[model samples]
Target: MSDPRHSVLLNTGSRMPLLGLGTGQLRGLENLMPAVDAALAAGYHQFDTAAVYRNEVELGQALRELLPKHGLERADIFITSKLAPRDQGPMAPAACQRSLDQLGLEYIDLFLVHEPGTEGLRVEDPQNSVNRAQSWTALEEFLSRGKFRAIGVSNYIVRHLEELFASCKVPPAVLQVEFHPRLAQTELRALCAQRSVCFEAYSPLGTGALLSDPVVLEVAKGCGRTAAQVLLRWAVQQGIPVIPKSSNPSRVRENAQLFDFELSQEDMDRLTGLDCGQRFDPEDPSLVA
Candidate 1:
């Protein structure tokens, strides 16, 4: 990761690195510091975390110490966090403030509603819709107070986005969802483009489960790249921002080396043909909590 070769302009008038590190299931200084330190060493300025990640304090401290070591500052790193499912509705603002407190930052670069569904309420419940609308209003308050630069949603489909748009005064600036060559999310990407929302891909490599896919391997070999690079590049080339989490420094560096290579029409098409609406981690309402 040395000077990430590309950046995407966010709807909030900010430039976000197309390739960043995702901090999930990474908790405590023991687990987070090394990755954060290595990511910074490898030149990763963008990071994605969440309230439910239980590692915000660690992420915050790592950045606080590591940024200066890299000759960088808070302004140099773009951090994104999300609202937990348990914090939906009017409780959203409190959750936002809590995340701010956990990160020990004056302002957050980006904030997102973790899901259209929640922990306390059944995902299929009609109340989820009401909670979503009220949550958007609460998020707006957080934005107005300068707690965050931009606000968006995660795990949201077109219908969910439509609902958010219908009730929200400030539409979402970014939509974070699982995406990879095999899970292209074409219609959702189109929806975001149509609405001027920057679409972001999480698990761009399908949570490390798609790295060994036949198509990915073939494309990587033909391009003289790693499967991870091929997969991340696929999303970037399509104008979707991607965050691929890895604890290995080599893999982290490899993930950001996409700008140096270009995927030819043939390779691109082959990879595109791999899409079958498959997802390694499907959004299960039963597991929302």
Candidate 2:
């Protein structure tokens, strides 16, 4: 038998592959396609992208070029895109269609609200939550129309999910967040799980922090893997689907070869102890409001 495909249950009651290629900071369009090429060859069938990444066009081109080489159809792959901040409200439906046009796809496997709330919304602004809830209602409509097979939110805190759940007809199918040992997000993760919502971790390798940690290095030495692999495997073993972004070809391949071994209970405990909830993302309270 071949290697087992690791999967996570989506809130749509579907099983999505646990690992995905994240296209966050792919700077230029030219450089983006090659990384996308490498990741596809490495068996990454799921892809995570957002409009803010500004590389959806490049990502679309790569998919068109590569999937044919592997004899895979569009449905063979799972593709995700997010709704941008400016694209909120009744206009979001049209924006989702535009994203589909950019990707050259009929339907997105998943669509997300890029953040909990839009930027420039201040504290105690009752309209802030109301606006986000309204945007989510639009997303829910898209889900109904089958434009997005699944709908979710990224960078949402527990409070944000709670309010959305209270106001919207559809709860988020997934929550994509910046989670790592340093920023454990245990409570938020648990809350999503309780609602049968899939949780995805963005920046799971601690955004290069794992590369320099002495403790992580020691663990990697013992495990005979690189610090990056150690950190990724830790997240996978914890049952969180992690998308670690890497433009380097070698690192892209290395990130995918993580299903072979299980971390020991002791090592898992040690990894958990490393959490200081250190967040790499700059504080944007607008996101949590």
Candidate 3:
């Protein structure tokens, strides 16, 4: 069993591991299997993937092969997949089903809308709002049907979340975004806190750009941890779940060694002070209507 301190209770009464293995850019059984093996051995109980990542099939295969070897079952782990932007609105149901098919899962622990805007639609288009509402409605139906244990959205900003709140019957259980020391996302985090939405983080290492940062390096040195550990620690220490992706087996194991050490208040403050609202992901949800 994973440490209780490493997991948080979602609004849907599900326990989500704060330190998950991100499957973005990790494709093929050859690449994903070892990472999955390392993750499982390192006590990771959560795996996050998306349709856009185009590796759900391989991830499913890897898990099926690796979980038994690790003495684990489907119920012991949490899996998350997403509806692609191309499949928003009327196509959401099919997309959700396809993700389940690709992942080879009877039910995903979480399913998130991968982006705020639909494909081929302008950010300011009114249809985006309608499509988002319809998509959420479809997800709500799936939740009722037990296709998804919890539903959420990714890369959504304040306006996007507010619009969803006004119309959604079941509020989101999680809101995943690119969060790190450089991109603290204070306002969005506060809104999610107020709404009881679990604010989760992806790219917590700033998409590999923050590893060499002087402040991060200094903090890592002070804590005798790797830069990746320091950055991931900054988020999970705040009770924010994080999925920091890496295909290297050693790095995967190394990344999971976050629960042993504690950062001082001064170190935490110094890291938080690095927030300049810098976002590493190219897709800016703020541009979406």
Candidate 4:
């Protein structure tokens, strides 16, 4: 069983593991299986993926083959996937179904609107808001039908979330965005806390840039943990869930060892002090209307 201390209770009354394997650049069953095996052995019970990643089929296959080996069931693991921006609005229902079909699962644990805007449209297009509402409505319908146990959004700014709050029938259970020591996302985090939304972190390492930072290295050395672990811990220490992507088995195992140690308050403060609103992801949601 996953340690309860290492997981958080979501609004849906389900516990999501704090440390999850991110299957973003990891494609192919051969490549993904080992990483899944490593993660399971390391006590990770959640996996994050998206249709845009194009690895859902592989991830599903890996889990099916590896879960039994780890003596786990489908319900023991949390699977999070997203609806691609291109599949926004009217295409969302079919898109949600497609993810379920690809994953060979009856229902998804958590499903997110991948971005704030629609594909092939200008960022400031008014239709982006219209399509987002339509997509969210479709997701709500799926949630009602039990196709998705929980629903949320990704890369959404404060405005997008406020608008969603005003119009959505079901509030988002989680808000995932690019967050790390360099990009703290203070406003979004505060909003999520105020609304009881689980604020999740993607690109927690600043997409690998923070790994080489002198401050991160000093803290890692002080704590006898790795730079990756320090970065992930900084988030989970504050009740945030982090999905750090890595295909290497050793790194996957390394990333999962976060709960074994804790960072000092000073270390945490230094890390948070590194925040300068630097975003590694080039796709800025603020640009979307």
Error of 2 at 83 (Å): 0.9
Mark the regions of model 2 whose C-alpha exceeds 4 Å error after superposition.
Answer: 1-4, 285-287
lDDT of 1 by residue, 67-118 (tens): 8888988888889999998998878878989999999999998999998886
Q: Which sections of candidate 1 miss by over 4 Å?
A: 1-5, 285-289
What value does the lDDT take at residue 83 in candidate 2? 88
By the lDDT metric, which is better: model 1 or model 3?
3
Clashing pairs counted in every model: 0, 0, 0, 0
Task: Tell me the tens digit of each residue's lDDT in model 2 across 1-289.
Answer: 1123587777687667778888989857577777778888888878888888988888888888888987777877888899887776656777788899988888889999987655566646566676677778878887898888999998878888888888778888888888887878888888987999988898888779778888788888888988888888998887788888888878899998888887788877788788997888885543455
Q: Which ten residues in a row are the worst by lDDT in model 1? A: 280-289
Candidate 3 overall Cα lDDT vs. reference?
0.94
TM-scores across all candidates? 0.95, 0.94, 0.99, 0.99
Better of 2 and 4 by lDDT: 4
Task: Tell me how far the alpha carbon of residue 188 in candidate 1 is from the true structure, in angstroms, after superposition.
Answer: 0.7
Worst 10 contiguous positions by lDDT, candidate 3: 1-10
Better of 1 and 4 by lDDT: 4
Error of 3 at 173 (Å): 0.2
Q: In lDDT terms, how accurate is model 4?
A: 0.94
